[model samples]
Target: MVDKDATAAVSRSEEGDFVKSTWEVTVTSPEGVRHFPVYRTILKVPPVVLRLVQGELHFESALEVLHRREPVASGVLAVGETLRCGDWELSLHDRSGKSRAVLECFTDPFYSRIWTLHEQVTRVGRPGKRENELEIDHPTMSREHAVLSWEERGPVLRSSGRTWVDGVAAAETVLADGALVQMGDLLFQFRLLSELVLARGGLCVTSLGSFQARVHGELVTEKAWRTQAVRWMLARLALEWGRPVAVERLLDEFWPEMPEDKSRNNFNYTISTLRQVLGGSEAILRATGSLQLSPSFLGSHDLVALQRTLRVEDWGAAVELYGEYLPGCYLDWAVAMRGSLEQQVLQGGLRLLERYEASECWPEVLELGGKLHAIDSTCQRTALGVLRAHLGRGNASEGVRFYERFREHLGVELAMEPSAELAALAEQARGG
Candidate 1:
């Protein structure tokens, strides 16, 4: 009876606690955008959110986060709206938004984030006592170092002082996707966003596994090509997609064994046939004694995608693009191209394997290692990688089987035994 007030206060404290709930937030950085789960508490801001916005994360800086168009802490979570903090932009969304978000994340770098012309011209350099869009804290940077502006071609970097584009000194240069720009001591990678909607659609040239062309997803058959000369000519042009091919080079490459006059006649006929096959004369551009596949018609090619993936170190995509390299095409030029592509595949695979192993991703290591070994059984590193992945996953029997098969294959194919390191791994798997 005497402590009635104290007892009521304790009871209210226990019953009035706030319930926490989890929500999905999409984080966008310079590298890409990814989603993260965040918790809501009635009493205070979430610690994780605070840390992310405070620039404690390894991959992002505050400028990238705050620069995102979507405001981060808008109280109500809108499905498509973005919220920014330090280096992360948290966009609220449901399950259906995942795929769209990922696609946006991939295409946005080239379409949305960098290309949204209305976002105003931004400056990059040392953050003065005040705020800036792209704050580079290095001493070499001035407070207002450079201005990034949207131009007719794309984004152009106008340097306030010393600046370099792709290692060349330039006061201003139009930027392309994947162009490296250096200002002061800090280096920035420029990604150009797509401006045009591609009304004419694009071409897909399948040169790796087979020779075929798909115009706007409709396959153009070999019969439609009319002749082998036309097919070869199309493949050659497709191989050197954006670059101009000299008429002389085309004659030599397409009909090298034929005489000059006959080759010239064949080249003209093949060009005419190809134009008909492509269904438009504008599909190929001729100017100043050089020919190139038109930018309007040439949209996406497998070889171009493969090279881009490799350049970006997207190893899994690179492996997928490296199908049967120019299979069934016995032309000397095709054979040479095939060899070059195969070498790139092997080298790219090895690099991928190294990265997977470093990250302790045993499953990916096994999968990529098996693929590499299938391509070239003589690859001792790939064989070892597969064996290690099996053992790492606690499948000793599978490791033993893989080693035995690899050893047998090596002996049969190259008349060689397993290397000492690989032999020791086999012994370890066998509990020797």
Candidate 2:
């Protein structure tokens, strides 16, 4: 029997096979959060089929599962792109305006398959007992219909039978990054790893400062969001970025107090609104029982970009990018990420400040030191660095003034004085 007041939730497990997935079932109540693992065949069970039966979850296989497959690129995907093996017609495009291809069959919309083209030469044709790079079982497809090859220009398609690129019949066409190719009656999207990276005009998430989402460099204002839930939903999705977040987890997080059925409905509604705000369904990538932001659409994210910039020793640019993560977002997940990012920048700034001071780059040192001090006012090293920077720049009076404020701050905040080393630096500033 189940507790009448308890709410049941399902979270995805890290491990799963093609046919079976282990889901962690959490039941939350006044007693506390208790749970168990439930196993379901991925092919047979959809996340929607779980229901409460006599106080426990009854997992029944749906009559027909929309057997979707998302195929990810075999090679390193572009910076903002995440390709998964799944059946989705992601209307992602490169700068040239050609749709980025994720191969899929149009006949069965519910049972579509997506494949990543990784090979130099890929043969496409009708399915047989023999294996081919891509196989279409349609009657219009020949045994060997078309061949795709990576060339100096890009992915080029050559057809032995009737084929079309972007609806026009063609013998050969250089696939524009993401081009829809029709071989006989079967249509497939063709793409290359190189093209996805080079593709331009995608989403840019700026969370390090004010929370802003820009699609193709155009800002998505607060008024654009239909609801606060929809806005936060995008924030959560963008925060996870490349990682696929479980749908069940989202339902629990977003509306734990609401009934399970109501939460699911709301979740679906939120996704619909988010899709509209993001431009299309392709902006959100769907995997098996999970969702992720489309990598192709995510052209630039300040948090991700800032880390990359820091890695390349672009300290100034990194500092410029650093801001409170999701400024007004007080959600638990947002707060946690904000703390981690703040620490990362604080540590990086300290290192850069040391390097600048060693090179006698006082202006850079002062800029970095002030930022680091703001992030961690209690740090004696930062205070000392700031003083030295001012002294180095021949601004002795300013250094003394800053030291006096720092001393007072330490006394009031911690009931302590500046460290001996920091005090000595302050003395030098005072003497000058």
Candidate 3:
């Protein structure tokens, strides 16, 4: 009864117990606004399925669900260069090409990827589309066998298909290729390997509690606060909302009555908590200001969308959407996603520089420059700050030269950490 013309079937027993991954990215290029479908393939020769225990997309890099590094291949990546990956494509490049922002994959694509959850760069698909991305775990070896009622389980790439994580059934639908999943409308599909499955698993399967504690950790250390009030607020937010929120916005929303000056200091205390958790070294917080959101923190998403919009502030919808109203712009969410100075530098510098360039007032440059410099000294522009640190003492010329280099790459200098060769060239440019 063998149907001829079909290739020799490899039985499930033959395919080896493992998984294969494919990345279906919808990129919004700087030039074109449409979300183009770009794909990357992730495959490892057999035995272990890409058992994503957990996965998250952070400012610096992508951390997997499992502790292992899964195989990944993408032209849009490089070492040390970190860019946000999700519903929209985002990346940074050195204008001067001195060195590109890193596209680092900590676990060599050759090894097994670990698991952890993070923001999904790619959005979920609409109903009725072939799985745009899927990892075939427990791959069937028998080529002849049809996928007989496969069990969808566990966490997958934010948008990957037919997965099983801790026996949870999580899935998204595509309209021939769409990303619209309505929980209320879903037909009890949550029987297994779904959101319900995860929720039900609770403390045992989900890391919500630990992640909250981590959020507080990020706040304290980075901001270096001197109080417990912010932590208390954070706990309340996590309890009320399902996630941690930005501290700044939290203050603005909840502490609306607090004086502005004190609010700033207290907000700082909140960020301080985050720092204590993540440590000050990892470049995890670059995008915190935007990552941390609350009822008032919607701006993070809006700000990002603005980056894609052709005409900013054009319509009533845009006005209402981008935090034009005060009540919707909370900052605690940023506190929740605390990361490193490198991350802050990338996020803040890009944002401020964009605002500064588009702005009518050049006077604000001083303030903007100060804030940018604080995150990544290179943004200090023409300030002597980076030079003092670079040369181990104050040196005006060195600082000037440093700025020249910084501007060449970042469009606006923060503070320079140029290599010896680049510094020499910078000095020459300054002299000229």
- Model 3: per-residue Cα lDDT over 1-432, one tens digit each: 111112122212211111111221222445443211111112111111111111211221222121123333222333223333233243322222111011111112211222211222222223233341112122321112111122244222232334322224434321111111111111111111111111111111011112123332222342443344544444334332223245456667656788989887766666565444334412122123422212111111223232222122222222222222112223463334333213533453445445544553344544444444544554333243233333333344755655665656554443335556546644644554
- True-structure lDDT of candidate 2: 0.62
Cα RMSDs, all models: 16.1, 20.7, 20.8
Cα lDDT, model 2, residue 392: 85
Q: Can you write out model 2's per-residue Cα lDDT over 145-259, one digit (the tens) per residue? A: 8887877887778888998776578998888744656666454544443221234337877777787888877889778897888988998998766456889899888898999
lDDT of 1 at 202: 60
At residue 190, give the lDDT of candidate 2: 48
TM-score of each: 0.56, 0.56, 0.21
Index of the highest-lDDT prediction: 2
User: Per-residue CA lDDT of candidate 1, range 1-432, in tens?
Assistant: 011222122112101111111234565667675444321121111112221111111122212233245432323334455556666445554442111011111111121122111234677668787566655556777888887776577667798777877668888888765455556644444432231111323677877777778887789986798888888888888877645678998887777899899998888889998998888887786754777676546555678767655554556667877876667777888889888877788888898898888888999999898788767778999988888888889999989998998899899989999999999999999993
Error of 3 at 188 (Å): 18
Residue 14, model 1: lDDT of 9
Model 3 CA deviation exceeding 4 Å by range:
1-336, 340-370, 378-418
Worst 10 residues of 2 by lDDT: 13-22
lDDT-best of 1 and 3: 1
Cα lDDT of model 1 overall? 0.61
Cα error of candidate 3 at position 233, Å: 4.5
Instruction: Please give the lDDT score at residue 337 for candidate 2.
Output: 86
- In order, candidate lDDTs are 0.61, 0.62, 0.30
